[model samples]
Target: MSEIPSTDEALANLSMPLLDAMMTQRAIRRVKPDPVDDAIVVKCIELALRAPTGSNGQNWEFIVVKDQRVKDQLGKRYRQPWSIYGALGRRQAANDASMLKILKAVEWQVEHFSEIPVLVIPCLRGGTRVPYVPTPFVGETSYFGSIYPSVQNLLLAARAMGLGASLITMPLWNVTSARKILGLPLSVTPICVVPLGWPRGRYGPTTRKPVQEVVHLDQYGNRGLTP
Candidate 1:
């Protein structure tokens, strides 16, 4: 979509087939700095509410950030880590075309971070660890695992609405700083940030390895169905 979609238009767009949305939903890091409709954003989060959470805890919170000052803070944090990692990634991907493409896109996002229209910070309320107590492996997994499904739903909804979006965590590398910047209390742990805007590029089918290559049959080493 070349222009910012109307609320009604965006809502109507959400009926896109599940498989179609999944197939084309690549991380869209390059986006225009246009205002997105609040209704659309809420609808996406509403659909996200449908995803199951661990133990039905549903302890998820979505912080929609549009303030430039807040984005600038997050952007500063993002650049801090990206300065080192981005250099390393560039060197590692020097001979890889596909990887270089992704790196370039990321570089654009880092540079224009403050301009992106909306950022959705998915957070979890409650802690797996008590003071002086060690959280078990399952406790850690269940805690973080609770919010990702909803994040996936949010991403798919963005795709269906033709809104460019990408999931990122580097911006929140310093949890304390992120919490302070977003005014988040200790009980709420921000999982990741999903920056949303209208696409500067178009969404199309993504490249991936064939299913057989990654799918193991019954055992860890069994690559095919006929193990």
Candidate 2:
């Protein structure tokens, strides 16, 4: 295990090159239970605020959870859905080593979730005046479109600071229950949960398909300039 850095050392790591951080960022599920500095957690959210929102509405809220009881409640929510999904996943990936590896990591995370140090829940607060009212498709897009960019920013910041973090929505499967658990008003929608702590493993380069394989020129299926 890597030695835990002083808060100053961890904050200074934010100067790491953006490309390096982006390329190496991955869902780090396993982490130590050591308490993270309040300043470090705040800094990650501060950077997250830099991301763009739909119409610049900035209708975002972040709930930083450190309480063990709250974490246990969220863990229960996670397990409720995962029990069924995990069984399905194992059966589906029975013959695929790569997929089985990913499932195993998720299993570990689900089992140890409450023991993780922090849970940052990002939320959205504005849209329809009436809560839970159905909106048109475009309205729907604009409504939920606001939170993801900020989430990417948060993930990138976590990567720069060498914090282990992963974005998961499973714990939020039951919105009504989640709202009650977090004491959120109906206007605020909890988008996803980001679990954070010092890593049990290290961050490294990720494998992905070549850009050319997925990129198209001008329109779909138009491989312009490709010989």
TM-score of each: 0.97, 0.95
Q: What lDDT does candidate 2 reach at residue 86? A: 99
User: In model 1, where do residues sit more than 4 Å from their true spots?
Assistant: none
The local distance difference test score of model 2 is 0.93
**lDDT of each residue in 110-201, candidate 1, tens digit only:** 99999999999999999899889888999999998899999999999999999999999999999999999999999999999999999998
Clashes of 1: 0
Estimate the lDDT of model 1.
0.95
Give the CA lDDT, 0 to 100, for residue 73 in model 1: 95
Colliding pairs, model 2: none
Against the true structure, whose TM-score is highest?
Answer: 1
Clashes of each: 0, 0
At residue 41, give the lDDT of candidate 1.
92
> What is the lDDT of every predicted structure here?
0.95, 0.93
Give model 2 RMSD, 1 decimal.
1.8
